[model samples]
Target: MAENGFQGALTYIYDPAILLRLTSFQAEYKNGVTPLNPGETLKLRPLCLEDYDKGYLQLLSQLTSVGDVTREQFEDRFNKMKACDDTYYVTVIEDTTSKQVIGSATLVKEQKFIHRSTARARVEDVVVNDSYRGKQLGKVLVDVLVSLGRELGCYKVSLECKDHNVKFYTIFGFEAGKGQNYMQIRFFD
Candidate 1:
């Protein structure tokens, strides 16, 4: 597989068979878009440059106070993000019928030296389009990300959500505030 393992180094040889399987898997994925509603062909995929201008960021802003970014700003950031193998995987839910990005969630793999060089994954920035709420798209999005985190060999997967959304996320196996407090230090306003 030749992926970046603990200590941030490739510890195995690149397997062509694995690559072929991944290619075939992606081909099947691209062709099979999940239908969520009538006239809406939704599919889940990794973020691509082609999705930059398709209201992807707008959907994200609905989650938090992320200001708008110019196309150049997004391009620069996307380049750096994609360069790091599977460290940052932002999965988007796209309506292929309308070519609109309606939902997104990110799975971040954190390799650690503790716990016998184990790794964990965090899910964040989960949101769905305002018009698409109550369709269970958010649940579908988080489930996909959790599956991905498991495939990445993460020992645990976690996420922090607003108090109101705690119950919503709990159904996905996340313990709501289980003897742990979430604190943050912001470097920017």
Candidate 2:
């Protein structure tokens, strides 16, 4: 049984060894596109329950405010997301040597009625640990998710980033929509 007591739940959510089966890493990691520092051992894979104790929330704190989220609360949310198969793809990069989640990004696929019922994807919560910056981890995360969106057959993948970060995303072919505005009404601070 898995840690969550749900038999084979981890495999059901995502193949724990997905990285071993991916061929894109061959090209993505070529020419030091996102090369790691000397002696650094990192593995990119899907999020799992064990990540709660592996600094997953701490990694997010480097990006924004992550309030007092307890283990139960975290597990509840993880289970909910896991339950929604084919919808949430929360990928993480872990430092195998330290067993810490150093980076993460989410790709959410939304089913639609238009365009012959094609789906669209939204990229969210992209972040890398402050200490791990400049190692090209952010580029790897974005590239993986964007390629995942294409592999999943999403009509388009979109994300919102601060003005200063716009240039970084452009490298991945993301462009600002002309005459389009991003508006949001916050319900809480």
Each candidate structure's TM-score, on Cα atoms with residue i matched to residue i, is 0.77, 0.84
Clashing pairs in 1: none
Q: Which stretches of candidate 1 lie over 4 Å from their true place?
A: 1-40
Badly placed stretches (over 4 Å) of model 2 are 1-13, 16-40
Error of 1 at 184 (Å): 1.7
User: Would you list the clashing residue pairs of candidate 2?
Assistant: none
Candidate 2 minimal-lDDT segment of 10 residues: 18-27
User: How good is model 1 by TM-score?
Assistant: 0.77
Candidate 1: Cα lDDT at 85 = 64
lDDT values for all models: 0.67, 0.77
Name the lDDT value of residue 37 in candidate 1. Answer: 22
Clashes of each: 0, 0
